[model samples]
Target: MLFSLIAFLGLIAGLLYLATGARPLKWWRPDTLVAHDLRTLPYMLSYPFEAPDSRQNIIFDSASAAASSPSSTTPAPATQNSAGAAAAAAGGVATPPNTPPSASRAGSHAQLVSTPSSASIGTELPGIRAASLDKLVQRLTHHSISDANFAANFLMTYRAFSTPAELLEKLIHRYHVPLTPSSGRGAATYDKDFVHPIQVRVCNVVKLWVKTGYRDFVNNPTLIARLKYFVALMRRTGHEALADAVIKSFDKQAAKFAADEAAAARLAAGQVVSPASGPSSPASSQPGTPRPGTPVAGLPASAPSTPAHGSLATAVAASPAAPTSATSSPAILKTPVSRAMNAHIPSRSPSKEEIIASPIPMMPPSDLVADITSFLNKKQGSATDRMSRYTAMLCSDSLDALEIARQITLVDYELFRAVEPVECLEQAWSKKDKLTRAPNVLAFIKRFNDLSLLVVSCIVLTPDIKARALVLRKFMLIAQALRELQNFNSLVSIVAAMNSSPIHRLRKTMELVPEKVRQQFKAIEDLVGASSNYKQYRTRLHNLDPPCIPYIGVYLSDLTFIEDGNSSKVEGLTNFDKYRRVASVVREIMQYQDTRYNLVAIPAVIKLFSPDVSDELGINEDKAYENSLLCEPRAAS
Candidate 1:
């Protein structure tokens, strides 16, 4: 029995060893000498001292080993003596008998060392493991988009057989799967064509790579080199779609980088980077689009001819072979607003009919408070009936909803226009100063909060699980629509309402929410979450075509951060640079005031969202939890 137990333990140990060395074993199979040589290194170390006699020498005979080594097995590059021979051949001079090769002062040595070929540069470094890197490269064309994206991102993320640039170069030049366009040189039929298995796979791989990895490529010099280098190669190899995708991605990052660098340089040099240098929104573009490089009205081109280091100039300079058009003069791309967030202005001016503004009346805090109380008192319906009315409000026409959003933005711009950024920063100005200077700003924030509170109350008060679920679900849908409409003002309020403590704490009601509805809510919640400083929201905001509402909270918070973190002056001089950056954001928000889309009447939604006596419910955290437990008691195990 003891013998049998010992045998079982020995088997387990052997299995563990095999499991750990599985890949190594595969790499160092019987036919492979590579791993065998690597593994033999510790045992192959030379003695520190020379052998006492020639016969006792430990080192193997070079001639015998060379002759015995299999001809089919390639020698490592490091073992080659080509460099010495090449240097001697180039100079046509043999080394002097007394002179050691290292001691020789030949110009050929300098010439050979100074410039390195791509292959030599790559091979000289300890690069990624071929087995793993090749595996990853193979997976780049995986059937699943997520798998393909994962492989592409991972390839650039980890350092392996070569630097990222060299590895990417290998992927493009040595291992790239070619994508065939259905028609040569014509519009790409690949988008519509379903045939060509390998071509389709390659196209999808490239598309996902560019879409997912563009940000990394833009930020990383090595990846940038890889992107630019591979793009040209792909284009030459007749993969137009892949090449175009790279160009499109690079163009966006490059343009933004160039504009920012120009602005930063101007600021550092104590020159006012003109607002015109900021990217112009298409919404603000005049009847005739301004020509590239021309200064916008009311702003002058202040950027110096010479760009400083770490700027887009350096990025562009690194890739001189890239097209001149691809790296257009930085001045042309400059505008006060982010190019990504540039609102899509109507190609033709807004027709007179589309120019209606929201009909929601802007009232003072006291008036709004009274109006809300009056509306609540006059409310005449059961919770179910109220939900029916709420559904109708949620189902408001998309255009009308957009108009409401526009109106809200209009009011937002008007109220906050006079509130300087400094007032929002702690220690910069007192709370009294903020209120005195911009009472409207305070009123706007209060009204939105009140509306949010009211919505939460309405949902929490509705006792029926299905009715509450319906109301919550409808609100989620409306919020989504508001996001699509780019009316972030309303969207923010709706989201805040749904996520309020009372509504969020309703365990039983929440359980009644459909799985799809819950997923949709989670998605929207992620968008507005504080993660990455609301990066998802900003991305979505930028992606939407203009005629959208700017989320006021984001911009306000931005100003607050800028004001608190930075001083108003540097070296006793007014820091116009800080002011300029702040002004650009403010100007962009103000620009929305001119939007032509106006809100049509949706009285039910307006009333539903308006503050009510429910605001006095005082639903604290403890109360919410208590109410939640009452509705859905935890099951005893």
Candidate 2:
């Protein structure tokens, strides 16, 4: 029995060893040499007198290995070699005799590291270190998935670290790296066989840069010229496809810029630009029909049709109205007796004919409050009937969280896209005259706050614990859907509402929430959390494609930092850097605006979002807190 027990224990140990891949034993007796193993193995093989400091010895050994294998790899260019020598000197490492200065400059001592060895070109780096310009270019032009991802990120955010001119220069230098074969080798064979792949990758990188970040070239004439020259060089070298793609992207951006300029010119001239009246609009399709909002000769001037809501009409309306001069009014109305008569006249609601006949200025709805005034509105029926309907739609098990999220995103996206880049550039949304300067931005903010309050109201107003939990779960699911939809604007709003004091303090209600939901909520919280300055949220946002609505607050904060931290002039020169940085942020905001969602708008779901109904739902922060107390009273002190 004792032998059997021992045997059983030994078998269990053997299984664990296999399960762990025998890692513990391998630590003491490694099957292969690794970086850490090198620290001791060299000393172990050397005589006592020859022993050297492990770290420095490792550097020395690398230098020696590189020096001995000169023909095994391509030699770095003269510029790189000099930079590596400078880096080695700066690091206090002595260059070895009989070794080329570049050879003595190991990867650890980098002024600028040479091109990576062929084996390392497409492989993942073991760890991140400061790479030289040449190394960065190599990585940017490498043919590997990991390298492609790195290239995308670098191109997207490179403005923050390097100037466009500097990057362009590096790319040109990489393109010109000598491809001449060694003596006695056929130049044609070397050019055709060896140099072709390198040239292809360089051209591909340039094409990607132009395709994804053409704005960089568009905003700078010098860069544009440089890019054109590069394209010409590429064509001369036989990369016609990539060269053509670069030129096509630039031309596309130019056309878009021209269209924007035309739109701005029309706006400035007081012309109403309809959103639906694009190049392919029905009005354009039939040239005979006058566009909506345009005055037809036969129609009375006051009878010009009103454009759709949330259109550029809002922007036009927000502009300061022209003051009515006393001379412009009738003499009788200007007189004191006439004014007295006007004061005595009782005010009345405008009739439909009167409202239609009145010259309505293009603008946002003047009323700040939603149409849904109260629960007791006569049109909505008796209070009990209203409650039943609300419960049926919101609290019923038939609620489609994803559909709800999509509808919200649809509305939110319209508001988001309406924001013009100039509004952000001028910081108009934060100004006291925001109504006049950034009406669309203000509208978006209003929607965001209203959504947050509505979320709170829904959860706290439910009288039953189970129903409240159900509402909470529904919202959590909606938040998940929002995240999936890449609508961070609404996602952050809902998460903020869920985290509000009123909803968060419901201990019993929260306890009833399922564990899976709780975990999901936790993840959502982490994603939108303010920790590390919203690092996780920013990372996730950068990874997302367009048809997304990012939280404007992040961009606003970035603008604030740029405005406050940098001076407009540095040493009497225009601080172009500050403006460049601001433009970069604005471009990112505009980038997402160009892509509209493909989701079909449901009339019923949209009706629920009607401003009137939303207001009637009583989406007030104070009311939410009161409802929370009524649902679950405070604990005894």
Instruction: Count clashing pairs, candidate 2.
Output: 3
What value of lDDT does candidate 2 attain over all alpha carbons? 0.51
* Residue-level lDDT tens digits of model 1 in 21-97: 32122323222223123322322222111112121221112222221111111112222222322321221212112
lDDT of 2 at 603: 30
Q: Estimate each model's TM-score.
A: 0.38, 0.45
lDDT of 2 at 244: 57
RMSD of 2: 27.8
Cα RMSD to the true fold for all candidates: 26.5, 27.8
lDDT of each: 0.40, 0.51
Model 2 misplaced stretches (Cα beyond 4 Å): 1-378, 381-388, 571-573
